[model samples]
Target: MQGIIDRQLDVLIYPEIGMDPMSVQLASLRLAPVQVATWGHPETTGLPTIDYYLSAEELEPPRAQENYTEQLITLPNLGCFYRPWGGEAIRLDLGKLGIDPRSPLLLCPGMPFKYARQHDWVFAEIARRLGRCQFVFFIPEVTNLAEALRRRLEAVFAQYGLNFDEYVIFIPWLNGPAFDGLLERADVFLDTIGFSGFNTAMQAVEQGSPIVTREGRFLRGRLASGILKRIGLQELIAGSEEDYISLAVKLIRDGEYRDRVRKRIETERHVLFEDMAPIRALENFLAKVAN
Candidate 1:
């Protein structure tokens, strides 16, 4: 660590840190004079030595800087350049998975840990309100925590008066092509609140599926929203839990509105993918810090 720091790196960024203990340990050390935290985890590292949290200006909400201990450096646009994984490919067959082709399908793709326990109520509420819809959940191969989450969600359904069979389908992770195929079949992609899904949202948008996102106070929470903004579809951005549920239900049920957003995503998506404003913002920040 000392050797790397000795080379005089003007900026060393810990892309994401909170989840990994080693990152926290390294963060405890003053490695770089202008060390920055970025969207890898998108939350505060709470390290005194870590100087800044670089995020998109539009991605964060008002007063978002208040959330972090370090000085906040909100970049305009995405704050980074990225590419969507995989490409146009064969989608998964819903029939093989026992999913009815006619049913409204909502895909929630994220790690089990990203799904907070309190979020079950939102799912339960959606089910109760929508009355009929299928939620596809991708669980990790290791069943311990994922299975526990399924059971807990089932309980939430019961508590919320959802008496439907197999309302939530728990399945194993799909490989890139198969996952893209499955994403093609979904009508609405529900983003995990708090810690948003950046790549998953991109994949879903690439598949031309409308997504429901709620902008969070933190940078992590606003990732998917930033992506959505890139595509020029703010109607899908939900401001509250009720708004999230309403937008999801609307996207699931209203074919016209859903198709409009899907069309926007398909036709205007290039604006979202290749913008270099963020790269410029980052470069400027590095230059300013170095000076």
Candidate 2:
């Protein structure tokens, strides 16, 4: 680390951290390396070694950067990391999963546990509104701390009188192939706030399920709104909690709107893959770094 700083490296890329004493040591020397942070929350470290915090337009002026530091450089819309399963290629055996294709299956890819607490309430309300409808929730494998948090969330569900066994069927995480199968069996995909499921949402949409999401201040929240808007499904994007619940309830109750969203998503699935915005941004970023 000392040698790299002494040599004045072109760039140094690393993930975000809360606070590391070593960063203070590095910053004291006034290192000129261009630091880039990715994947985690778009925040600042207030370290002088850190020259730039890289992030998408959605996360522009990352919360930490806004409140703590001014080292953020907002990138153009680089798009999400995951792609939806192309609708035409997805196939499923509903009977094997004990799901009846004839019955409405509301598929929520993963529980909103981390930052989106509203999902807990939204999903519970969804279960209440669509009583007895088969709702399949795919629970992701969380680590030690995250697992503990998930347990607390589950307890909250019970407190709200939501019977996980009756309304929701918990499915273990699967590999790509198995996940695709689940998507095929699902009738609709639900999104969380402050950060939508980019890959999961796209897969659900591609698999012919209409995705319903709420917009928020950050990129994590605005993803669904942006994608739906881009693909001409703006009507499916909810503006608030009430709007999200109303849309979900309407989709479950109004056959015409539900079918229309489904068909429209299927018809427009290709556009997401073919879109050039993400590609161009990636190319530009790579070029800048290379130079």
Using TM-score as the measure, the top candidate is: 1
Per-candidate Cα RMSD to the true structure, in Å, reads 1.8, 4.7
lDDT of each residue in 1-291, candidate 1, tens digit only: 778678988778887787688888887888877888887887788888988888777687888878988888877677666676646667667878877677799898978888888777888888877777888888787878888878888888888778645588877888888888888888889999877998888888888888898888777788889888866788888999899999998887789988888888989777666668888887888889998
Give the residue spans of candidate 1 off by over 4 A.
none
Candidate lDDT scores, in order, read: 0.82, 0.63
**Tens-digit lDDT track for model 2 on 186-289?**
65677866666666776666667778887776545665666676578878878788888888888888889888887888787676675566567756765687
Model 2 Cα RMSD, Å?
4.7
TM-score of each: 0.93, 0.73
Candidate 1 — which pairs collide? 16-41, 91-181, 92-181
Give the CA lDDT, 0 to 100, for residue 26 in model 1.
86
lDDT of 1 at 92: 67
lDDT of 2 at 11: 62
**In model 2, which runs have C-alpha deviations exceeding 4 angstroms?**
1-8, 15-32, 39-48, 58-72, 78-90, 98-102, 115-119, 142-163, 274-291
Specify the poorest-scoring 10-residue window by lDDT in model 1.
Answer: 80-89
